[model samples]
Target: MVRKFYPEEFKADAVELYSSTPGATIKKIAADLGVHEGTLSAWLRAAGVTTVPTAAGRADGGGAGVPETPAEELERLRVENKRLRADKSLLETEREILRKAAKYFAGETTW
Candidate 1:
Protein backbone atom coordinates (compact mmCIF):
# COMPACT_ATOMS: atom_id res chain seq x y z
CA MET A 1 0.00 0.00 0.00
CA VAL A 2 1.10 3.55 -0.80
CA ARG A 3 0.24 6.87 0.78
CA LYS A 4 -0.56 10.13 -0.95
CA PHE A 5 0.57 13.61 -0.01
CA TYR A 6 -1.34 16.81 -0.39
CA PRO A 7 -0.26 18.78 -3.49
CA GLU A 8 -0.41 22.17 -1.83
CA GLU A 9 1.47 21.03 1.28
CA PHE A 10 4.13 19.31 -0.80
CA LYS A 11 4.67 22.34 -2.98
CA ALA A 12 4.83 24.68 -0.01
CA ASP A 13 7.36 22.46 1.72
CA ALA A 14 9.45 22.17 -1.44
CA VAL A 15 9.68 25.92 -1.82
CA GLU A 16 10.45 26.39 1.83
CA LEU A 17 13.14 23.73 1.83
CA TYR A 18 14.77 25.01 -1.35
CA SER A 19 14.76 28.65 -0.26
CA SER A 20 16.04 27.93 3.21
CA THR A 21 18.81 25.66 2.08
CA PRO A 22 20.03 26.43 -1.40
CA GLY A 23 21.84 23.78 -3.51
CA ALA A 24 19.89 21.04 -1.74
CA THR A 25 19.89 17.71 -3.58
CA ILE A 26 16.52 16.77 -4.98
CA LYS A 27 17.00 13.07 -4.25
CA LYS A 28 17.80 13.68 -0.59
CA ILE A 29 14.90 16.04 -0.19
CA ALA A 30 12.51 13.65 -1.86
CA ALA A 31 13.69 10.79 0.29
CA ASP A 32 13.25 12.85 3.42
CA LEU A 33 9.78 13.91 2.28
CA GLY A 34 8.78 10.37 1.28
CA VAL A 35 8.28 11.19 -2.40
CA HIS A 36 10.08 10.47 -5.63
CA GLU A 37 12.75 12.88 -6.75
CA GLY A 38 11.04 13.35 -10.08
CA THR A 39 7.79 14.08 -8.34
CA LEU A 40 9.38 16.73 -6.20
CA SER A 41 11.03 18.25 -9.28
CA ALA A 42 7.71 18.33 -11.10
CA TRP A 43 6.11 20.01 -8.12
CA LEU A 44 8.80 22.66 -8.12
CA ARG A 45 8.32 23.24 -11.84
CA ALA A 46 4.57 23.57 -11.46
CA ALA A 47 5.13 26.05 -8.66
CA GLY A 48 6.75 28.48 -11.14
CA VAL A 49 10.28 27.97 -9.87
CA THR A 50 13.05 26.64 -12.10
CA THR A 51 16.83 26.60 -12.18
CA VAL A 52 18.53 28.21 -15.14
CA PRO A 53 22.04 27.46 -16.34
CA THR A 54 22.99 31.11 -16.88
CA ALA A 55 22.33 34.46 -15.27
CA ALA A 56 19.83 36.96 -16.64
CA GLY A 57 20.93 38.96 -19.74
CA ARG A 58 23.80 36.52 -20.36
CA ALA A 59 21.81 33.71 -21.90
CA ASP A 60 19.14 34.03 -24.56
CA GLY A 61 16.89 31.63 -22.74
CA GLY A 62 15.06 32.90 -19.65
CA GLY A 63 12.73 31.45 -17.09
CA ALA A 64 8.97 31.60 -17.56
CA GLY A 65 7.32 35.07 -17.75
CA VAL A 66 10.47 37.00 -18.62
CA PRO A 67 10.85 39.40 -21.56
CA GLU A 68 12.88 38.16 -24.53
CA THR A 69 15.43 40.86 -25.21
CA PRO A 70 18.47 41.23 -22.98
CA ALA A 71 18.95 44.77 -24.25
CA GLU A 72 15.54 45.81 -22.97
CA GLU A 73 16.32 44.57 -19.48
CA LEU A 74 19.82 45.99 -19.64
CA GLU A 75 18.58 49.50 -20.38
CA ARG A 76 16.03 49.34 -17.61
CA LEU A 77 18.63 48.15 -15.14
CA ARG A 78 21.06 50.85 -16.27
CA VAL A 79 18.49 53.58 -15.65
CA GLU A 80 17.69 52.31 -12.19
CA ASN A 81 21.36 51.84 -11.36
CA LYS A 82 22.12 55.43 -12.38
CA ARG A 83 19.28 56.78 -10.31
CA LEU A 84 20.37 54.84 -7.22
CA ARG A 85 23.97 55.94 -7.67
CA ALA A 86 22.94 59.60 -7.84
CA ASP A 87 20.79 59.22 -4.75
CA LYS A 88 23.65 57.60 -2.85
CA SER A 89 26.04 60.43 -3.83
CA LEU A 90 23.60 63.05 -2.71
CA LEU A 91 23.13 61.32 0.64
CA GLU A 92 26.88 61.11 1.16
CA THR A 93 27.29 64.82 0.44
CA GLU A 94 24.51 65.66 2.87
CA ARG A 95 26.13 63.52 5.56
CA GLU A 96 29.46 65.28 5.03
CA ILE A 97 27.84 68.73 5.36
CA LEU A 98 26.11 67.70 8.58
CA ARG A 99 29.37 66.37 9.97
CA LYS A 100 31.16 69.64 9.11
CA ALA A 101 28.44 71.68 10.80
CA ALA A 102 28.70 69.54 13.92
CA LYS A 103 32.46 69.97 14.04
CA TYR A 104 32.28 73.76 13.53
CA PHE A 105 29.87 74.21 16.42
CA ALA A 106 31.95 71.92 18.64
CA GLY A 107 35.07 74.13 18.06
CA GLU A 108 36.83 71.60 15.82
CA THR A 109 38.70 72.48 12.60
CA THR A 110 37.23 75.67 11.05
CA TRP A 111 38.16 74.78 7.44
Candidate 2:
Protein backbone atom coordinates (compact mmCIF):
# COMPACT_ATOMS: atom_id res chain seq x y z
CA MET A 1 0.00 0.00 0.00
CA VAL A 2 1.10 3.52 -0.72
CA ARG A 3 1.86 5.80 2.22
CA LYS A 4 0.31 9.24 2.31
CA PHE A 5 1.92 12.36 3.76
CA TYR A 6 -0.07 15.13 5.41
CA PRO A 7 0.99 18.72 5.89
CA GLU A 8 2.02 19.98 9.35
CA GLU A 9 -0.92 22.37 9.40
CA PHE A 10 -3.29 19.53 8.71
CA LYS A 11 -1.81 17.48 11.54
CA ALA A 12 -2.10 20.41 13.91
CA ASP A 13 -5.71 20.96 12.88
CA ALA A 14 -6.52 17.33 13.38
CA VAL A 15 -5.04 17.35 16.87
CA GLU A 16 -6.85 20.53 17.72
CA LEU A 17 -10.12 19.14 16.42
CA TYR A 18 -9.73 16.09 18.61
CA SER A 19 -8.86 18.20 21.65
CA SER A 20 -11.64 20.72 21.23
CA THR A 21 -14.65 18.66 20.22
CA PRO A 22 -16.52 17.22 23.19
CA GLY A 23 -18.06 13.76 22.67
CA ALA A 24 -15.98 13.37 19.53
CA THR A 25 -14.06 10.14 19.04
CA ILE A 26 -10.78 9.73 17.22
CA LYS A 27 -12.31 7.02 15.08
CA LYS A 28 -15.18 9.29 14.07
CA ILE A 29 -12.96 12.29 13.45
CA ALA A 30 -10.42 10.28 11.51
CA ALA A 31 -13.14 8.81 9.35
CA ASP A 32 -14.47 12.30 8.70
CA LEU A 33 -10.97 13.58 7.85
CA GLY A 34 -10.18 10.61 5.64
CA VAL A 35 -7.27 9.47 7.84
CA HIS A 36 -6.66 6.37 9.86
CA GLU A 37 -7.66 6.30 13.55
CA GLY A 38 -4.13 5.36 14.58
CA THR A 39 -2.77 8.31 12.66
CA LEU A 40 -5.16 10.62 14.47
CA SER A 41 -4.16 9.09 17.80
CA ALA A 42 -0.49 9.61 17.01
CA TRP A 43 -1.16 13.21 16.17
CA LEU A 44 -3.10 13.62 19.41
CA ARG A 45 -0.30 12.05 21.48
CA ALA A 46 2.33 14.11 19.73
CA ALA A 47 0.36 17.19 20.70
CA GLY A 48 0.21 16.03 24.36
CA VAL A 49 -3.53 15.35 24.33
CA THR A 50 -4.85 12.66 26.64
CA THR A 51 -7.39 10.10 25.44
CA VAL A 52 -10.16 8.38 27.34
CA PRO A 53 -10.96 4.71 27.17
CA THR A 54 -14.38 4.10 25.65
CA ALA A 55 -16.81 1.41 26.72
CA ALA A 56 -15.80 -0.61 23.66
CA GLY A 57 -12.31 -0.88 25.24
CA ARG A 58 -10.75 1.40 22.64
CA ALA A 59 -9.03 4.67 23.40
CA ASP A 60 -11.12 7.62 22.23
CA GLY A 61 -9.90 11.20 22.05
CA GLY A 62 -12.56 12.52 24.38
CA GLY A 63 -10.33 14.21 26.96
CA ALA A 64 -10.79 11.63 29.72
CA GLY A 65 -8.46 13.06 32.39
CA VAL A 66 -10.27 16.37 32.68
CA PRO A 67 -13.40 16.35 34.78
CA GLU A 68 -16.58 17.78 33.37
CA THR A 69 -18.56 20.42 35.18
CA PRO A 70 -22.09 19.53 36.29
CA ALA A 71 -23.54 21.58 33.46
CA GLU A 72 -21.28 19.92 30.98
CA GLU A 73 -22.29 16.51 32.20
CA LEU A 74 -25.93 17.46 31.97
CA GLU A 75 -25.51 18.69 28.43
CA ARG A 76 -23.72 15.55 27.44
CA LEU A 77 -26.45 13.42 28.91
CA ARG A 78 -29.05 15.47 27.11
CA VAL A 79 -27.31 14.97 23.80
CA GLU A 80 -27.05 11.23 24.43
CA ASN A 81 -30.67 11.04 25.38
CA LYS A 82 -31.73 12.76 22.22
CA ARG A 83 -29.65 10.43 20.11
CA LEU A 84 -31.06 7.37 21.86
CA ARG A 85 -34.61 8.58 21.40
CA ALA A 86 -34.00 9.00 17.70
CA ASP A 87 -32.57 5.51 17.52
CA LYS A 88 -35.55 4.08 19.35
CA SER A 89 -37.92 5.78 16.94
CA LEU A 90 -36.03 4.36 13.99
CA LEU A 91 -36.09 0.84 15.44
CA GLU A 92 -39.82 1.09 16.13
CA THR A 93 -40.47 2.12 12.55
CA GLU A 94 -38.42 -0.80 11.26
CA ARG A 95 -40.20 -3.22 13.57
CA GLU A 96 -43.57 -1.98 12.41
CA ILE A 97 -42.58 -2.46 8.78
CA LEU A 98 -41.42 -6.00 9.53
CA ARG A 99 -44.61 -6.79 11.37
CA LYS A 100 -46.73 -5.63 8.45
CA ALA A 101 -44.69 -7.70 6.03
CA ALA A 102 -45.04 -10.80 8.23
CA LYS A 103 -48.80 -10.36 8.42
CA TYR A 104 -49.08 -9.90 4.67
CA PHE A 105 -46.99 -13.04 4.03
CA ALA A 106 -48.95 -15.11 6.54
CA GLY A 107 -52.23 -14.27 4.79
CA GLU A 108 -50.75 -15.22 1.40
CA THR A 109 -49.81 -18.76 2.52
CA THR A 110 -50.94 -21.66 0.26
CA TRP A 111 -51.98 -24.10 3.07
lDDT for each candidate structure: 0.62, 0.78
Please write out the lDDT profile of model 2 over residues 1-111, one tens digit for every residue: 999999999999998887776556888889999999989988888989887444443555343355666775676677667767878999999999999999999999999
For all predicted structures, in order, the TM-scores are: 0.39, 0.55
Report how far residue 105 has shifted in candidate 1, in Å.
63
lDDT of 2: 0.78
Candidate with best TM-score: 2
Instruction: Name the lDDT value of residue 97 in candidate 1.
Output: 100
Q: In model 2, which regions exceed 4 Å deviation?
A: 4-24, 28-35, 38-63
Candidate number of the best lDDT: 2
**Could you tell me how far off, in angstroms, the CA of residue 34 lies in candidate 1 after the best superposition?**
1.2
